[model samples]
Target chain A: MTTPVLEARQLIKRFGGLVATDNLSMTVNPGELHAVIGPNGAGKTTLIGQLTGAIRPDGGDIFLHGRRITHMPTFRRSRLGLARSFQITSVFSEMTVLENVALAVQAHSGHSFRFWKPALRDPALREAAEQALDFIGLAPRRDEQVGNLSHGEQRQLEMAMALATKPRILLLDEPMAGMSQEETARMVAILGPLKKSVPILLIEHDMDAVFALADRISVLVYGRIIASGSPDAIRINPEVKAAYLGDDDA
Target chain B: MSMNRATAANMVLIALLLALPPLAGLMDGEFYIILVSRALILAIAAVSLNFILGFGGMVSFGQAAFIGIGAYVVGAGTMHAFEDGIEWLGNGYTQLALTVLFSAVAATVIGAISLRTKGVYFIMITLAFGQMLYFVAVGLEIYGGDDGLSLYQRSEMPGLPDLSDDRVLYYFSLGVLLLFLYLSHRVLHSRFGKVLTGCRLNEQRMAALGFPTYRYRLVAFVIAGVMTGIAGFLLANQTDFISPAMMHWTRSGDLIIMIVLGGIGTVFGPVYGALAFLLLEEFLSGIPVTIAGYRIGEYWQLIFGPVLILIILYARGGIYGFLQPRSNGK
Candidate 1:
């Protein structure tokens, strides 16, 4: 009965004629890894966008830590310990990996209005950034530009950037998409321990990864949740099997 | 590994530029002094534009409007003083300060209105606002209409070193420009600057993270305006005149060209660009182009067009771009 870290109630989003996220309602308790699984065009990303304030829902509300945050700006949400790792993996291409994390840490550490102190020389910001990189296993690529990094490394850096904000909840959109099995295994290994501290709302298409990692699974078909339960219950749900996980499992 | 090396190099560069104005006196090159002054003033304006256009991804084409605003403030302040001259610091210093302060306020007001729109709308709206000022300047009968208002007297300082000296003014202007450059660099390296860059790259992502990008962008626009407004103040002092020609869209285009030619988003790039642009103008002005023996003195812009096109085509990185090798890593 603890207050959920993220709670979405009857969220609806539309694009003129198309209903993207239709009547989707969900909740994530603290430290719970909740996976939202749906086929392509099932509005999972749209739902995620609505939750993260990138797109406003037509109807309903989203609350973070029992607070009405649906109308809040993204940075305010992040300042309040809600961080979202982009599905597309956004990072400063011209900057070093360490600089990327350092900037993120700096963004959250205190008032960024300090204009005199050169950011590169700041020890506190650097330490926090270094620690975040260390956690994401990108400490070695600290000086390398994010643009020069491999896709996997960029994804890791994205995670590090998100973690640097020191969030109570992490919203990840398809973290395992377009990754090799080896990369996925590494991500799973890294994420497994982090989930112990922070609640995660993972929207991933990778079923194998989802099955292996997610504590609870929710089935979304064209924006509506068909079922929500423990992994075993979700796998056996008839509505989920018929609507999403068919025989071929595409 | 030490940051001091970069700072040391910058200091050396600053010294070289600082020594140039003094050498103009030794060489008896008043025109050279004038040329460098114009370049520095324009560079100040262009550098300010780079903050919004280069760093913030706001491709503005009406920066000249701010310069125009500054010119008017100076002209109007001086006009007001002529009717009722001053007692203490004289009318001119008060006029100059009024111009700078009012130019900043005007820029803030304009930016508040203009930053609401984005993309092509932003571009067109800024252009429209600049053109609005252009018409207003043209219509003003109190000033000079097509012809700019001439200053009755140069700005005065009430203290030691007497501000009437040309070399003194040059040094003062140079000091101001360097101060601006330092402040600009500080802003770019700030956390606010990083987020601004982030907004440029992916505003949606920045918004999702928690920052209201519109407010940030508006603040950037205002900051850029104030910076450019300072340049405008210097510009009026340099010219000792004010006209509608200052806000013309072509002038704005020239500012854009300066940013691109120097290297957008690079520190001190606009300074190099403004100097190059003015030098090219000077070089072209000296050569009277007579195609098939027909004289063309004012038609030098035609020749400059081809050169700019060549630069755009070959040196995509601009002037600084040409200096730096492209590794294509990013």
Candidate 2:
């Protein structure tokens, strides 16, 4: 059996009196789209943070390809083929689209101590950035300043940046958040093919997209998963319906 | 192809600077050489300050302390050479090497601590360090304490052009500035420069991108310190004096003003800033008019103050920004 691309075993996180993540365990196998659906403040983001090494879990170990990385720093985790897109559209707005992606490519490629030659002129970096931008359908806007891009475009750029790192797994934190319906559809379209190439652990609120795209769905409520199964099983699970899917939405 | 306005302006500026020494010679204005040399030296310091402030997003309010550190290296070297007969310490090359070494150490210590904090806290901490250095200089009785030390001669570079000649000194200062400008251009466009710029714009994003940003910033800080220390070496040689006053917070403020007035992140901005600042000071302070029995020139800052505000308000990117064509607005 192939090892899971990512595995979080009994992760726990607490904030003062509140338990943000409680005994959360999940896995994304190779070539799988695992969608995590939860209500607001169900610790979805906190889970992503712990996986990315931005936050330390109170109890549990995270493994990437069977190698423990629970205590790795954020950057080291990224270098070890873990990439994440923020819940909010976090990007280097002052730079150009290509420049933003190039930086991500630069990060994974090698050390950035090249102090004489112009970074943008490097063919390897430029080509990789272009490919990532093209994959996200943002190649035409490559030279435009990020601040000038539309909100949806910036969200797409975030995906492109994560993609440029050539990660073994992608952690998407509400990639569709704040996107308009058209933009959401565009993002889903981008994700549909992307999941075939890299395993993705997606935290999202849009049910239709999740149901359509997710191979397996995990329904989280109050910082713990109530159900985890194939899309059909999750849709029919009685506990998921009562706790999260609500009869009307289900 | 037509050159852009900023490139054209930069070219013109370089040409004028190159021609200044010869032109001053033609006009027999030896005094102008000294004035312009002093301006160029300060411009070097301002450029180093901008390296961290503009490119790295480190607002170091105590940059003058590096300059003081550098100049004192020169002063201390000369003193030990002449008074104590520690001859090698007086060597210009040795002083330059020591200046680089000492300032790198200072920047590492200061940056390691300051970089942990952001915004106003960073500013305050740097200011505190600068003040500490200033007071330390004041308490050094062997170095003349608060009164300052007088060097008997300019640093003796055995194999190079003599720095004693004002014209030679002007050319030397200009050469150093050009070298730094070239280095700045190379470094800013390089991969390391991109990372540094990224840190300035969005440090969090940079960290997530697999960059250990604190290490990058600390390295930039050290490089900037070394550059400023070199400027201090020249400044001491130029004036033949060093004092605790060089490290005062106000001098550090002047460096920031020069960066802002010229262009914050632009390579040639600080040079323009230093020239504008010194020339304005000379011109405004020379106004012979008396306002109610007080010389107007003595209070030149009153007029200068309003002008700086107007520039900061109206000039979005300082003078260099104005030089660029509108389409390239940051």
- Using TM-score as the measure, the top candidate is 2
- Sorted into a CAPRI-style docking class, model 2 comes out as medium
After superposition on all C-alphas, the RMSD of every candidate to the true structure, in Å, is 2.6, 2.0
Q: Candidate 1's residue-wise lDDT over A1-250, tens digit each?
A: 9989899998889999999888878999877899999889999889878877778789999999899988877678888998888888888777789878887787677666565667867899899999999887889989887778999889888889889888899999998877888989999998888888988999998888898889999988877887899888988888888888997763
Clashing pairs in 1: A74-B209, A74-B210, A75-B209, A75-B210, A75-B211, A76-B210
Error in Å for residue A196 of model 1: 2.4
Q: What is the TM-score of chain B in candidate 1?
A: 0.90
First chain TM-score in every candidate? 0.97, 0.97
Q: Model 1 compared with the native: what TM-score?
A: 0.93
Q: Residue A132 error for model 2, in Å?
A: 1.6
